[model samples]
Each structure stands twice: as C-alpha cells, then as structure tokens.
Target: MADTSPSEAGNAPLDQMGLDNFAPYLMNRIMGRYNAALSAEMAALGLTTPQMRSLAVLSVTDGILIRELAVYAVVQQSTLSRALDALVRDGLVRRETDATDSRATRVYLT
Candidate 1:
C-alpha cells in the first residue's frame, strides 16, 4: 500500500485547513443555522424541510413532474412522494396524471 501521510501526500491535515477555506463545510454550517432558525416557523405551518422545499420549487415551477421536482427540491424521490401525499391531503397542492404520458404525474399548487 502507498503511504498517504500528509508530508508524502503534500496535503494539509483537516485540522490545519481552516473551516472557512472548505466550501462544503461552510455551506453545511450556513444551512444548519438557517434550518434551525426556520424550523419553528415551518413547524407552525405544518411543514417539514422536504415539504417546504417542494412548495418553494412548485411556487416558481408549477406542474413540474414528480421526478424533476425531486431533483429541483434536492429531496429523494421516496421522501418527496410522502411529502406530496401530505401536501395533497392538506389541499396545498394537487397532482394530476400527465396528459401526454399517462404514467407520469405533475404537481400544481392550489
């Protein structure tokens, strides 16, 4: 096996690498704080992160397909499916079979 020590690899150790210098770390920290601040407001409205994300995406792009919505909302297809079910049940959104492709479903805000 090849040695991957920091001196041999010419890479700084994680502790030596400042957190701000890491884009993903910074983004995760920011999002964590944002979510913590928003959680209570969302809960009061009976929404989870995935549900809120779905509504945010649907607001701008109504009638988007379920698979596409999952990508745009950054949620898993199965998780979005459950969220959509709740949204539909609460009358916040509706789903209709796609006219062109009967197998596909499109979502719309109500």
Candidate 2:
C-alpha cells in the first residue's frame, strides 16, 4: 500500500546507524567537544562560541555589513543578531549606519 524502499524512507533511522557514520552528527560532536574545551576560556572573556566567531571575523575584517558578517561568521541573521546585541552591549563591538545605504548596518570591533 505504501512505498518502503530505501529512497522513500529518506535517511536511515538513527538507531540503525552508528553515530560516527552520520556526518552531521559527527561534526556536531566535534564542535561540541571543541566548544566544551573552550568554554572556560570563553567564559573568562564573557563570550559564547557564536559571539567569539563574530568577534573573530570582525577583528580580521574590521568593518563589515551585518549581512556580510553573518556570511563570514556562518550564522543566520536572526542568530547573529543576538551575538551582536551582546557584543554591542559589552562594548566589544560597534554598529554604525552605512552612509551609502540606509538599510545596511555595518559592524566593527571596538
């Protein structure tokens, strides 16, 4: 009555596959371990992984539009917004309206 082929089933069930066999899961696990190791150092500086990434990118690029920053930082605008908000509040980063484009907002490290 219903298709039950491998293609129709989409991804294999998690229980059927070893955790190491899933790329997404493996990447997440790797990042989780790295983040865990970095947690103490990050906490001392009052930064999360995303916030650290945002700052790191800004530090290299200096001034970049929020959209561009999101690209380099590998985060969605909505997600980057939270990190930017904290950085702005902490005085670690600054935001200025773009002179040529009213709708574009540029961010820079302080």
Using lDDT as the measure, the top candidate is 1
Evaluated at residue 81, the lDDT of candidate 1 is 97
Instruction: Judge candidate 1 at residue 7 and give its lDDT.
Output: 44
* Global local distance difference test of model 2: 0.88
How close is every model to the real structure, measured as TM-score? 0.84, 0.69
Model 2 CA deviation exceeding 4 Å by range: 1-24
Which residues of candidate 1, in runs, are more than 4 Å off?
A: 1-13
Per-residue lDDT of candidate 1, residues 6-108 (tens digit): 8467566767777877778999999999988787789998899899999999999999999999999999999999999999999999999999999999999
Q: Candidate 1: lDDT of 43?
A: 97
TM-score of 2: 0.69
* Model 1 Cα RMSD, 1 decimal: 3.4
Which numbered prediction scores highest in TM-score against the true structure? 1
Residue 77 displacement in candidate 2 (angstroms):
1.7
Residues 77-103, model 2: lDDT tens digits:
999999999999999999999999999
Model 2, position 102: C-alpha lDDT score: 93
